[model samples]
Target: MKVIIAEKPSVAKNIADALKIKSKKDGYFEGEGYFITWAFGHLLQLYDAKDYDSKMARWKMENFPFIPEQFQYKVKSDPRNRDRQDGGAAKQLRTIKSLIKKREVDGIISACDFDREGQIIGDTIIENINAGKRVYRLLLNEWTPNAILQGLNQLKSNEELLPLRNAGVSRQWADWVIGINLTSAATLKFQKGKGQALNIGRVLLPTLKIIYDRDKEIENFKPEKFFKLAALFRTKDGKEYEGFYTEGKEDKFKTKEYLDNISGQLNGAPAIVDDKTTEKKRELPPYLFNLSNLQGYITSKYKGWTSSKVLKTAQSLYEKKYITYPRTASNVLDDSLTGKAAKVLEVMKKGLPFEEEVRFRKSKRVFNSAKVDSHSAIMPTYLVPKSLTRDEAIVYEAVKNRFIMQFMPAAEHEETKIITKLRNADMKGFFVSKGRVQLTEGWKKVENIKSKEALLPSVNVNDEVETVKNKVSSHETKPPKPHTEKTLLKVMETCGRSYNEEDTTAEAMEAVLSGFSIGTPATRAETIKKLTDTGYISALGKNLQCTDLGRRLVETFPVKELFDLEFTGRLEKSLADIEKQKFDKERFLQLIYQFTKEAVQQIKTGEDVIIHEIASSKRSTEVLGKCPVCGNGVIEGFKGFGCSNWKNGCKFVVWKNDKFLATLRKKPTKTMVKQLLTKGSANVKGLTSKKGNKFNAILKYEKNPENDYFSWKMEFDKKF
Candidate 1:
């Protein structure tokens, strides 16, 4: 008997069905002299810090940079493991080993997914079991029976994939060292007695850094003044055409004198006609849905659903055989696979928005083998989904449509441009005419896409037109917008670099961009949770704002390292090197360890510090009055008295943090007051104390309106 071990139960079931295994056993399905079993995600994980050494459990500078000589793995335990601490994976491992030793068992088939991680899983399991049986990898591109049978006949020796296994092992160990050491060091050093846990990782830090950098960009940006000139003219057809004033050098109107000159000259003159050009072009249907691309589109266009959510739903669809593999990086299919796409389309023809497109010319746009890796982008299989959850349905539809759309003809259109010269109206000045594709509805002939499709009007330079309206709209230079989830993903994917899709620089960033994207789809949601839990960031609906603690943490760090995109770019390159099996994992680990150590040392010795005074502003004189209790200070804005003497031990802070004080509701009544015995009182309404208790108080105040000073008194009246 031959045994096949799969990555997950879902995958095992698919393989079983494909191999015509009708009979199912307790832990596996058996048929055709084969036994197949599966594993949950990473049934075994690397040892924790304490597992290395008991002393290392408590984080310290000396303990950190915790480079274990040899990494260890352990099985995770459950509640039922009360008596037996051997753990789940260990028990499972033993059973598999026992089965491998059976006289009836001949060999093993590593039927895991065809990815780096999958390779590691099978290799590690076999290594732990010390199984000397002949094993080969079964490389199935799809879960269908035909694909499985083809893969079985052409199985490859697993020995050829040594680099992939090495790369995967290094990736895991590197993440462990970087994540635990940095997270522990930062949490212990920065949080101090608060014992706040700030989880950091290679991907998480870079990801959070992406968000914080975007926030900083929005914060530090100062809008500069620039002017644009728009000229309106009439064609022979009496159609109003808007032309922009063209200059040889001054694309941006920077100087006031330059702006004044340009404004005066082009204010109300007849814009001259210069040139006209038009071209016909075709827009190909986009390639199929890779997991990342699908996630990005959903996050941007739909909102709420994250990349992980989309992946999970797509994976479920794949397991159900409603679609092909969900974890593929390739958007195009193999040449051989393209022939089978028409059959997949036939199964998906009934309800898709692009059903007609599927039945049309699918030869040009269908799956191309050159774009495929171990798996193709997700497409519907022979199995049709009868029911699904709301999000699952949405993701299913997205994948289904993309798969079908890829088989359709390229959407065609004509792009037209018309430029005319106004004779010496100004140097290099011209009135431009523009026209585009005559048919706005033909794109629907391929796919019924409404959102991205552009509609254009047909026009010619000689057509007579008149300017019916003339208007000058004033606009201001705007600061860059704060980081939204949508933009942050893009930044992470590109590692903070800006580029066009086809640019070589942009393409170079793609591996690192997609690889180090903030965090893995699995952990990104949890990382965001940590930021909110630490009071570093808060959400006002979907909008995120830094709290006092959050802002201070950012301010405490060097601006360049904290906010610079180049910093992330360099780190991404290092990470990419690991994936490429070029960079030494140990050196990468050392770099992160040293970085954490330096950051902790910097915070420990508070050199070159800036203090933010509690007072709201220097202009509030009422906050400058002498303190009644202290008898030697002025009442500060939005808080207790601040000492008149600078060099003294007056470290008094009376109000809550900036956030709580900002959200008040009403004024206090006399009955609400009861604080004279302890300190001065005032009838402040709706003011919540530091403990989050809301109350009104009666306190006396001597107000000098001229100087805007107030001194509290222990008296109050019922009405103003």
Candidate 2:
């Protein structure tokens, strides 16, 4: 018998179903000479600083740049209470370990996701248990039954995954070293109060810098006024169209008076078509859905949808066998998948309206071995889901339609450009009119998006026409728009360089595959979500703007390299090289260690500064009440009601989302804080209990003598 460990319970269940194993056991399934177990993503995590040395438990300045000789692993800690191990993770790890040690088991197969993180997750658990059985790895992009069975039949030895393991380990250790040392040092050096630690990470700083720089650009933008002349022209046959007047390829004028004088001369003026050109153009459908492109398409087209939400939805479809891997970076399929892709296309186009047009043929645009990486682009699997949630349906149809459109003919259109000259006027410019007409719907029929373009009147070169109307339109140059999640993800995926979405040249593909991006497609969404969660950036109706804290950190943080996009991209490229065995893991990690030590030292010895300053201009001057700890005036700031004497080390503040109050389904309001500060306690109604029972109670905020931190105490007049 052999044991199989999957990344999650859903995956293990899928594997068991594929293998026809029906017997269910605690924390795993058993049958068909196999015991299939699963982990809740990661069953183990690297040891904390305190685990390496008890003296490092309390972060102190003297314990600077602490590096462990040998890293160790432990069961993941409970999220709610970090002091204890998670019960579920511990129980599952025990289950996996027992299965590995079973006398009947001859070999173990790791059925985790095929990626660096997945390799490490399974490897760490197996190594932690000291399992001596021969090990194999099952790699499959989709969780379909056929894919699973085929993967199990062709498993690779665990020894072949050393490069991936090295890369994963290097990334993990480097992040820990940089995160722990720099976060602690920055907090101690610059942060003035508790609860908000300066979050410094290898990926977080660069991503934050992207938003901070954009925000700064907007803040300093200067708007300028401009004008343009437009004319309404009529052909001899009375057909009408509008054209913009251009002078030597320049349509915009710095002064409105100049365009106004020109506009006055063109009214009712005789015009002749000086030149006319028509060209046929063909536009191919967009490349297949990679994780980043899918996220960008969905987040930009739909309201209230974020990149994280799109990824989660796509991942669900993949697990359900509706699509291939959704975390892939490659935008094209591998040549080896041609047969499978053709079969899938046949199955998907059976009942579509454009079924006749969907013909499968080998095209380098869709399938190229040189462009593919570890996994192919995301497309629908052969097994189509009969039912899905509304969100799932939206994402599923997108992938399905994109897949079908690839096999259809390219969309064709005719573009016409006409240059008309004012014959009787003294103006030395011409009015240009352009129009597009769809020649063939082709792939566009899949989306029912008919081409909408200006329809020009029938006219030829040297044809006389009358200019009926002319006007000078005044406009002000607008600043660049704020970064939406879609645009931001693009910049992150391309390493801060802008590229046209339609540009799929070999050079563009090379840029994407250069391994210089801020984060992988699998990680960019999570990074953005983390920035928002940590209050470094905020989403204001689809636009990402850096918060005051984020802006200040960018301007004041001493470690400029961390904020540099090129610096972060190079580190990412090094990790990619490590995975390919082109770079040594030890060397990469040593460089990270040196960088972390220097960064921490810079923070500790640099000039003292405060990144988090109470904006007095934004705070209400009317004192809410007296601070319970310092007896100073309490003022309402953006986040909470805090003591005015916060600079004096009095950490008495009632945050809006105080954890203790949140547990009782309550938040500290201005009225509540004022009453509590003056009367020692406040009667808060609608407070909830552990069982979700609601009642009225008196709440008090008092400093704990042991930790010098504030805690909430509740008192009820009568028990229910």
Candidate 3:
């Protein structure tokens, strides 16, 4: 009998069907000398910090940087699926163990998804079970029966993937040390009794830093002033042209007088044209969807779905074999599959816009095998999903449409440029203009390039037209806006890449240049969500704004040590090295422990003070004012603001009333002190009332920032 283990039950069932294992047992399918079972995601996890030592539980400074000597895993129930904990994991392990012990199973086959995490799950399970049988792994890139059958025929030995297992272990330990230690320290220092846990992870901190930094930029920004001059003209074709101010730096126009002197030279002068140039080119279909790209695309075009949502839907699609494995980093389609493009295109042709765009010819840009790593970016397997969520439909359409269009001919266009000399009375200068004309909207037709706008056409080199209308517009530089989800994702990608210090090899440089990002397609969305759940950021509308707590944390930390982009780059390089087997995993984890220890020490003892800005209260000081309730102690504080009680920790406070609402409300805004000073009575809402309903009077103030006093005039609403 042979034992097969799958990543999930869905894939297990598919494998069972394809292998002709017809008999369904309690927890697995068995027949024809084969038994197939599945794991619920992670059947084992690294020991938690508390598991290392009891002292780690309460989070004390003395027990800092709790690095375990040797990492160990335990058979555990998956946290995500909370329905059952039937010792199912152990039971499966036992069953596999029994098969191995009995020597009935000739070999064990690992048929998990094709990704880093999947590799770890399969390898770890094998290690724990001590499965002495010959172990083989099926590189199942997709969920289709054909893909599975093909994979089974090419099963490779488990030892062939040792580096991948090392990489996974390295990543897990690195995240655990940084996340647990920093989060514990930040929560204890900043949160006080609020107990608001601030989670800090390798990816999460960087994401939060992106948001917090953007907020700081916006807050400290001061608008600058500038001016621009435009000369508008009409052509024989009735097209409007706007000529912009082009005075070079050498022209030295710093004042209105300088601009006026130039304006005087051209008040009625004829503007000459200088140079024109044009080039023709074709834009190939966009590269296929890696997970992050899909998430970002969907987030912008349809605001309803987030990155996490897209990943889940894509995962479902992958497991169902509706598409290829969805977690690929490659955007390039495999060259071998270029012939299959027609089949995918056929499926797409039944759909609207794609129907009009499908072509039999393949485009070189979309068929590069060098760009494909482990399957291709997800594409439909000629199976259209009938029932999908709105997001799923959008993502499916995006993935499928790209696959269909990849085989179509390139988008062709004619680009044109026109240059002319704008002459002054004593000198000559150059002005240039350009445009594009479509020759054939090939693959562009898939996305409807025509209705979408292109650049305007350019005039001939010597073409000249009269200046019809011109004007100068003055404008001021505005501060940057807060980060939206779109911008934040971009920041995370760039920020992580900024830390990349690998040599400028074609792939490494391309990786850096693509600035396409860090974290896999599957994990980027989850990273973003984690940052928000932590107190490091708060969401306002679609914008992510940093709070005072967040700002203080970043600003207070040693920028070089804690927030260095270069440091992150090195870490990325190290992770890559771990995967490549250039570095020792145990040593790398030791380095993380040492670095974390220093960071914690710096956080605990560093004296850099961060003045936390108070929300809701903007005053800087307080002045003397008698308490309304006690009538004894005087309020005192900085920023001319204070509490009602000077002593004994009473929390009552007051702000000096402003009279801006008098005109809007057509009534006098009352002062709380006035209500207390005279019979505890003050006039409010224009017409008046006194304490105890004793008198109807309005208090008229002398209106001075200082030495202001009041007098009461008794009256009724009708006695105005």
Say which candidate scores most in lDDT: 2
Q: Please provide, for model 1 over 1-720, each residue's C-alpha lDDT reduced to its tens digit, 9 standing for 90 to 100.
A: 988888888888888988889888666788887888776656666777888889986667667567787888766544333223445566666666776777888888888777667888888787777778888888765677777788888888888766567657766776676667656655655554433355555555455555566578778888787665565666555556665544653445565565455556654454434445667776656667665567666766664555556667777776676777776655666667655776777776776564565563435335455435446666777667778877878888777767765555556666656554443345555444445553333334443565343332345554433333333334568876665454555565556553222222535335533454444333445455566655666644334556666665566533235344556555555654665667766686667556655654554454444322222344333433344435455434233334444234343333322222233333232222223222454455655554677766455544445544443443335672
| lDDT per residue (tens digit) for residues 1-720 in model 3 | 778888999899989887777898766788777788887777877777777787787888677767788888777744434333437677876765665555677888888766668888887787888867888888865777777778887889978877767867787778888878877775555444433465556666556677777777888898775655555655557676655555442322235554554445555456555565667788767767766566666776774466777788888887777887887656667787776666766766885654654566655656777656455766787666777766567778788777766766788777765543455455333333446678878776666657233465345555666566545556677888887666665445444443322122465435533333445555678877765554466654456777666676676654234465446646755665666678788788888898888877766776645323233444333334455445554333332133445444343433232222211222332243434344444444442122222233444322233432232333335452
Better candidate by lDDT, 2 or 3: 2
lDDT for predicted candidate 2 compared with the true structure: 0.87
- State the displacement of the C-alpha of residue 106, model 1, in Å, after optimal TM-score superposition: 2.4
Off by over 4 Å in 2: 505-507, 613-720
Question: lDDT tens string, model 2, 391-509?
Answer: 99989999999999999999999999999998868888899899999999899999897789778988889999998998888899898889988888878877766546655666556
TM-scores, all candidates, are 0.71, 0.86, 0.74
Better of 1 and 2 by TM-score: 2
Reference-based lDDT, residue 677, model 1: 20
- Give the Å error, residue 467, model 1: 4.8
